[model samples]
Target chain A: MPELRVDGVTKRFDKVLAVDNASFTASPGRILGLLGPNGAGKTTTIRMIAYITVPDTGQVLFGDKQVGPWSQKQMGYLPEERGLYRKMKVGEQLTYFGELKGLSHSEAVKRVKHWLDRFDASDWYGRKTNELSKGMQQKVQFVTAVLHDPELLILDEPFVGLDPINAEVLQDVIMELKEAGRTILFASHRMEQVEQLCDDICLISQGKIVVNGELREIKKSFGRNTILLDFEGPDGFLDDLESRQLVRINVRSKSHAEIRLLNDTRPRVVLDEALRHTHEISRFELVEPSMREIFVTAVTAQQGAEAIEV
Target chain B: MTNNIFIVAKYEFLKRVKTKWFVITTLLGPMALIAFIAIIGYVSISSLTSDDKTVAVLDATGILFDGLNDEDGQITFVVSNMPEDSVRKAVIRGVFDGYLLLDDQIISGSGEATYFSKDGGGASFFSRKLRNLVRSTVEERRLLEQHVPPEVFEILNARVDVNMVKLSDTGETTGGTEAFAVVGFIMGFLIYIAMFVYGTVVMQGVMQEKINRVVEIIVSSVRPFDLLMGKVLGIGAMGLLQMTFWAILIMAGVLLSGTVVAAFLDPATLNLPASASQDELLAAADFTIPSIEPAVFIWFVAFFLLGYLLYASLFSAIGSSVEQQQDAQSLMLPVMLPIILSIVFLQPLIEAPNSTLAIVLSMIPFTSPISMVVRFAITDIPFWEVSLSFLILVGSFIGSIWVASRIYRVGILMYGKKASFADLIRWARLS
Candidate 1:
C-alpha cells in the first residue's frame, strides 16, 4: 500500500478558515489518530484528504499522484455523518457503493457477502437499511468502506453511537486491516481508543495543527511526571499536596488518583507524603502523560496562545 | 469518471423503476384518462337524447300547416284546430311541451311567432325546432305563389358543408385544422405535465440524498457533476419510458375503437340525398382517421428532452440548497414561474399558431418546449424557426446545467441554514 500524504492543505468556507496549512502523512500498515476538539477543523481536513472537497491551497497526494478522482478509486471513506439509502436493501446498497469505488459487479457482490457474513449480519442482506437497528446499519456502513478493498481507509468518528461490543468488533477488524498493510486514518473523541490503537497522532486546534508525531514519542516528550495512586484511604493527602502546589491532580476517586507533579517536584517526595497519610499503598507508579491529557493540554495551550495574540 | 456516472445512473434508474408507484402510474394513468373521457362523452350524448318533447301548433294562417311534418323524431308537432286560448291552456295542462302560434302576417315574411312552454326559453331545442319548421313552411308557400320551382327552392335552402384542410408550404393538403388543434393541444399538455412531474421527481431525489447525507459518501467516490448528470439522465429516461408506454397504449386503443366502429356501422344505411356523388357519400359514411405526421411526435420528444433537462437541473440545484421541503418553496417559485407561464401560453399559441405572440413565445427556450411543439402541430412552422427554437433550447439546457452543477457542488455538503437565491448565486460563482 502506498503512503497517504496531505501537504500544507488549507480550506476556507466563506469568512471562516476551516483548515489552515494542515500537513500530515499516514504510512502503510499503521493507524493515524486525528485528534481535535469540536469545531477544530478535523472533519474539514479529513474531507480534503478523502477527496470529497478540494483544498483552497496545497495538495493531498497518494504515492506521487495528486489526490483526485483517480486517487479516490483507491480510497475508502466513511464520512462523519453516516447514512445509507433508507429504502435500499443492505446488500444492494453496499454493492452499489463498492461499484462506485471501481469494483466489478461480481467482485463487489462477493465482498459484500463476505463482509456481511464476517459481521454475522448475513441475515440483513435482503432487509431495507431502515429496517435494521442503528448498530446494524453501522456494520453495513463499515462494510461499504472496505468492500472495494481500497489501500487507504478514512473513518471519521467511526465508533460514535456504537455499543461497546460492536465497537470492539469494529476495532478488531480495523486491527486486522492494519495487519494486512492497509493505511487507516480515523478521527474520534474517544481518547482511550486513540491511545490504544494509533501508531501516530495529529492534534488540531483552531484550524491549526499543534502537535504531530508518533504517539509514544509525543507521550515521552511530556516525561514521566504523572503518578498513579491506588489506595484505600481518606484521600486527604491529595488535597494537601494540591494546596501546597506540590502536585496537580489529573484524576481522582475514592481510592485512585492520577497526580501530575508541579514545579519539577519529585514523585518520591509525593509518595513519601502519601505514605505518611496512609500505610496501605496498593499501587504507585510513575508513568508518561496519557493521550487524553496530552490532547487537552495541547488544545488548551493553543487556544490560550491565540487568545493572547488576539 | 464516465463509468461512475453510468453506475450512479443505473442505480438511480433501477431504484425508481422497481417501485410499485411506478408500475401503478405507468399502467393505469392512461386508462384512467380514457375512462374519464368516455364518461363525459356518454353523459353529454345521453342528456341530449333523453328528453322527448311535443308541441301543439295553432296555425292562424291555414297554409302554414300544409307541408309541415308532424314528427321529426325528437319533437312531435301536432296541427291542432283548437283556438289559441285552448292551445295555451293545453300547454299549461301538460298536453304539450309548448304551443307555436302563427298568423297570416307570416306569409308576408314580416310575421312574429311565439312558442310558449313550461321553461319559456327561446334557446330550448324544442322551440328552435318548431321555429325552423314554421319559417321553412311559410317561405315555401310564398315561393309557390310566385310559381318558383320546388327543386330550386330546395337548393336555395340547402345547408352547405365546409371541409377545412390545412395547406402546407409545399402546397400539399394535410389533416383538418380541428385534428391539428386537438393533437397540438394534447401534445402540449402532456409535455407541460411531464415537465412538472419529472422535474419535481428530480428535485425530491436530490433532497433525499442530501437529507440522508448519502451524498457525502457518494461525492467522495465521484464528481458532484457526474452524480447530478447521472440522476437527471436516469430519471429522465424513466419518464421517457412511461410516456412511450402510454403512447403505445393510446395507439392500440384508437385502433381497437376504430375496428369496433367500422364493424357496427354500415355505409348503405346512412341517410344521404339522392344527388350525393359516390365519393361524397363514402366520405360522409366512412370514419376518416386523422393521421398525425411523424415529425410532430419527433418534435414532441425533442422538446420534451430539452425542456426536462433544463428544468431538472434547476430543480436539483434548488433541492440541494435547502434542508427541508418547505424551505424550497421560495426558490421553487422562480423556477416554477416559467413552466406555469408556458402552460398559460399554450391555449393562445394553439389558437393562433402563426400569430406574433405564438412565434415569439415559441422562440424563447423557457416557453418553447411546449409552445413550439404546439405551433408545429397546428401549422407548418418554417424549418428555420423550428431549428432555431431547438438550438436555443439545447443551448439553454447546457447553460443551466453548468450553473446548477456549480450550485449543487457547494450546496449538497452545506447544512444548518436555509439557503437563499443570493447564496445560490454566490455558490455558482465559487471555484
Candidate 2:
C-alpha cells in the first residue's frame, strides 16, 4: 500500500479554493516533490495530508486507512513557518518535540544525540535554542520532524535557512531514509533541487497544479533543447543572422552575441552561422532547457500550454 | 491513557526543568524573595539608631518652654529667640519636621494654636504628638486650679484590664486564639494565589504553541492528552519547587532577621515616663510560631496541585484559539478576573464562610478553586463541599482537556490568523 495518498482533495480558505482537485500518492521508497511559488496550493495540500487541516471535500489516506481514522501519532510534519521556544535549551527542545512524536525519554535522548552527531551540532547540546545560529536551528527542526523515524515525512520548505553544505546533508539524509524504504514528501521553490532529489513532481501555480508526472517525463516534455553560443563580430552581425528558430537572444555585444535555438533546431546551425560571422567564437555548446525556464514558462504562461496537458 | 499521561508528564517535567528560563527563574525567584526581605530588614533596622528628631518651639508664652523636651529621641528644644517673623522662615528653611506655636492668650475657653510644616509633614505622628503635649500641659494647669492632687489624679487615669471571656450561659476564656487563627488563614491564602498565578501561565504557554502552529510538529508522534498532562505536571512541580525553596529561605531569613530585630529593639526599649508603672513585656520564649504547619504543608501540596490543574486547563483551552499575545490578553483577563475576584473577596469569606458570595463562588467551577481555598482557609469545610469542589474541579479539568484537544486538533494546523473564543465555544459544542 502507498504510505500516503491524497485523492481529489479540494480545500478552501473562505471564498478562495486553496487546493482544487489535488491528488497524489507516495509508496514506500519514493520522494515526491511538492513544487510551487508563493501563494500556490502546495502548502495547503501538504497541510491536508498532515492532518493539520481537513479538506473541504476529499480523502487523505495513510497506508490503507483514511487519514481521519488513523491515529495522530502516526505522522510527522514540519510546517513552513519555523518556531522553537527561544528560551528553551537545545536538548530540551528536541526532547519535547521528539517526545511529542511518541519517543520516550531514553529513545528521544538517543535519537537527539544521533541527529546532533549527524549535524555536527553535539557541542550545542546544552545551549539555548535562540543562542544557536540560523543553520543550527534548522537542523534541530529537521531532527524534530524525523525524531520518531516516521514512516512518512511531510516537510514544507525543508531546505529553508540551510547553507549549501547543509542542504546536501539534508538531501543525503532524505535519500538514506528513502533507501530504508520510507516515503518523503517535501515542498520546494528551488527547481534544480527538486529536479535532482524528487522522483515525482507536482508543479503548482496560482493555487493550481500546472504540471504533475514522473520527473523524467516532465523534463522530456519541456520541448526546448537550446544552446547558448557566445561568439563575436560587429554587434548586429549575429542579430541579423537568418536562424528562423531563434528561441531567445540573450546578450549581443561588439565582441560577442550569445544566441539560442528555439527547439531541437540544432546548435550546429547556430555554431555554423556564428562561424561564418566571426572567428572570435569563445564558446558554443548545446544546453537543455533548465527547470527554472520550464517553471517560469509553466507558471507565467498557464493559458498557452497549461502544464503540457498532463 | 494512563501510559500516555505518564509519557507526557515525564517529557513535560524534563523539558521544563532543562530550560534555562525555567532554571534561572526557579533559582531567581527565591533569591529575589530573599533580597527583598533583606532590603526591608535593612531599612527598618537602619531607621532605628541614636536618631535625632529636631523640633522648633516658637515659645511666645515665655513659660511654655518648661514643659517642652530637651535633646533626646524627643524633639530638640530649638527656642527661636528670633522675632515671630523668622519663626515660619526658620521652618521654611527646613530647620525641623514641624514647629509648635502657642496661642497669645492662655487658659481661655478656646486656645487657638497654629502649626507650620511642609504639605506631607503636616499630618505626621510627630506633629500630632506635639499637639497632644501642648493640650495636656494646658489641661494640667486647669486640673491644679481645681485643687486635685497630682498623685491622686494618677489613680483616676484612663486604664483597663478587662479579661476576654466567652459565655454561652456558662463562661470560658478563649483569649487571643482568634488572632492566631487569623494568621493561619492568611498563610493558607497566600500559597493558593501564588500557585494559581504561575500555574495558569503554564497552561497559557501550552495553548499558545497550539494556536501558533508550533505544536503541529510536536503532536504528530505525541498524543494530545500526554501533552496536556505534561505541561500541567511540569509547571505544577516547578511551582512547588519554587515555593519549597523560598519557604526554607524565608525561614532562614526570619531567624536571621529576628536576631537582628531583637538587638535593634533593645536600644529603643519603649517607655512612658509619666506612667505609674511600665507595661510588662510578654516573654519572647513563652511564644512559639510553627516551623511548618502540616495543614499548610498539605494544603500547599494538595490545593496547589489541584488548584493549578483546574485553572490551567481553562487557560490552555483559551490559549489554543488565540494566535497573538494581544488577543490572549483580552481573553486572559476574563479567566483570571474571576480567580482574582475570589482572592480579593477572601477576607469576607473568612469573616463568614457560608456568606452568599462565598457559597456562590465556591460552587462556581471557574471561581471555585480560589474561592474554595479562601473558604478552606478559615474553618474546616464540610467533606461534601470539599469533595464536590474536588469532584467538579477534577471533572472540569478533564472536560477542559477535551475542549482544548478539540481546538488543539484543529487549531495546531491553522496559521496567519486567530481563533476566537466564540470559535472555541462552537468547537466544544461540536461532537
Candidate 3:
C-alpha cells in the first residue's frame, strides 16, 4: 500500500472558492477522517483527491506518482451521492465497475462473487438493483468500492442510511481493510464514528483547514477540562457552577451532566462542589473534549476569526 | 485508458442488446413495414377493379356509336338510340352513371360534346376513354371516304412510347426516373429517421446514468470523454446492426418477387410498345429488380455515421446538463431544428437534385448527410462536391464532440439545479 498525499490543492467553482490551499496526508494502514460542517468544502477536497475533478492549483500524489489515470486505479472512491444501475443485475454491475478499474473479466467476476459472499448478499447476484431494498443496494455499492482491492479507499459519509447492525458490519470490514495495510480516507458528519474509527483527523471550515493532525494529539491539545458527572440527586450544582462562571454546562439531565471547566478552573474544585450538592456521586471523571465538541469549537472559532478579519 | 473506454462500451452495448425491446424491434420492424406497403398496394389495385360504371352514348354521328361501346372495361359504354331528352332522363333515372352526346359536327373536328349526370363529377373519370373512341371512329370514317389505304391509317394511328435511360460517367443504366426517385427518397428518409432515433437513444442512455447517480462512480474510474464516446459508439453499433439486417431482408424480398413475376409471365404475349428495344423488352419480361450501385450504399453508411456522431454527441451533452427530462426540452430545440429542416428540404431537393438550393444544402454540414445522399442517388454529383461535403461533415462532428465533452465533464457531476444554455456555454469554456 502506498501513502496518499494532497498538497496545497485549491479549487474554485465560478465565483466561489470551493477549496483553498487544502493539504492533508493519509498514511498506509491507518484511517484519516476528513471532518467539516455542511458546505465546508469537504466533498470538493475529497473529489480533488479522488481525481474526479482536477484542482485549480497544486497536486495529489500516490507514493511518488501524481494522481491521474494510473493512480485512479489504485484509489477506490465511494462518493457521497453513490448509486448503481437500477436496471442492471448486482453481479454484472459490480463486474463492470471492477473492469473499469482495470481488472480482467474473469478476475472481476471472481472478486464480485467473493465480495458478495463476504457481504452475505450472494443471493442478490441475479436480482436487479431496484428489486433490492435500500440497505441491500448499499451493500452492493460498498462491494463496488472494494472489489478492485484498491490501495487507497476514500469513503464519503459511508454510514449514512445504514441501520446500526449494517453500519457495525461495514465498520468492521473497514477495520479489517486498515489492518490489511490499506490507507483509508473517511469523511462524515457523524462525529462519533470518526472518533472511533479514525487515527488522524483533518477539520476544515469555510474552505480552509482549521485543524489537522493525529486525533489523539489534537484532542490532548484541547486540554482535558471536560468532566462527566453521574450522580443520583438534584442537578442544582450544574446551574450553580455555570452561574458562578466556574464551568460551562454542555449537557444536563436528572442524574447525569457534562460540564466543561471555564477560565482554567480546577477539576478538584468542581468535584468538591458537586459532592456538596448531590446526595450520591456514583462516578465523576475528567475527560478530553469529544470530536463533536472539538469540531464545533474549531469551526465557530474559525468563523469568528473570519468575521473579525472582514 | 483506451481499454477502459472499450470496457464501458461493452457494458453499454450488452446492456441494451440483452433487452427484449431490442430483439422485438430488430425482428418486427421490417415486417411491419412490408405489411404496410402490401396493404397500400392491395387497397389501390382493388379500388381500381371494384367499381363498375355504365355510360349511355347518344351519338348524332352514327359512325361513332360502334367504336364507343366496350363491355369489358370498368366503365361500360353502350350505344343509345333514344333521343337526347330521353337519354338525359334515363341518366337521371339511374339507368346510366352518365350520358355522352356527340353531334355530326364532330366529324369536322371542331364540335364539342356534353356529358350529363345527376352529379357532374364522374365525367372526369371516364371522359378520356369516351373522347378517344369517338375521335378515332370519326377519323376512320373520313379516311375511308377519301379512299386512303387501311395500312397507312394504321401507321398514322400508332402510339409512340419513350423509354427513359440514365446516362452517367459509368455508362448508361436502364432503371427509369421513378426508380431513381424512389431509391433517393428512401435513402434520404432512412438517414433522417436514424439520426433522430439513434441520437435519442444516446441521450436517454446518458440520462439514465445521470439519474441513477452512477456516473460519478464511473467517471472516477474513467474519463468523462471516454464514457461519452463509449456510449455513442455502442448505441451506434446497435443501430448499424439493425439497419444491416433490414437491408438484407428488403433485398431478399425484392429478389423473391422478381423471381415470382418472371416465372408466371411470358415475353411474347405481353402487350409491350413496338418502339421498346430488345433489351427493354427482355428487362420488362424478367420483371428485373432495379440494381442499386454499391457506391450508394457506401455513401449512405458514411453519411449516416458522420451525421449520427454529430447529433448524438449534442444530445448526450444536453442529457448531462439537465437533471430532469422536462428541463432538456429548451436545450433540445436548437439541436432538433437542423434535423427537422433537413427533412423539410427533402421534397424540393429530390425534385431538382442539381438546383442551387440542393447544392448549398448538400455542402452545409448540418443538412449534407441527407441532401448529398439524395443528390448522389438521382444525379451525377461532381467528385469535388462529394469530397467537400464529406470533409465538412467530419469536421463538424469533431468540433461538436470536443464542445460536448467539455460541457459533459462539468455537467454530469452537477445536481439539484436546472442548467440553462448560458451555463452550458460557461461549462464549455471551463478548463
> What DockQ number belongs to candidate 3?
0.70
**Between the candidate structures 2 and 3, which one is better when assessed by DockQ?**
3
Task: Flag regions of model 1 displaced more than 4 Å.
Answer: A231-254, A261-281, A305-310, B39-157, B170-175, B263-269, B272-282
**How well is each residue in B48-159 modelled by candidate 3, as lDDT tens digits?**
4435678888788777777665455766878898888888888888999988888778767788677777777453534555566556767787787789998998899797
Residue A139 C-alpha lDDT in model 2: 87
TM-score of 3: 0.85
RMSD of 3: 5.0
Q: Total clashing residue pairs per candidate?
A: 0, 3, 0
Give the CA lDDT, 0 to 100, for residue A85 in model 2. Answer: 77
Chain A of candidate 1: what's the TM-score? 0.94
Candidate 1's residue-wise lDDT over A96-210, tens digit each?
9999999999998899999999999889999999999988988888888888888999988888878998899899999999999999998888888899899999999889999
Q: Quick one: ranking by TM-score, best first?
A: 1, 3, 2
Q: Recovered native contacts in candidate 3, as a fraction?
A: 0.89
Can you give the DockQ of every candidate in the order shown? 0.71, 0.34, 0.70
Tell me the lDDT of model 1 at B331: 96
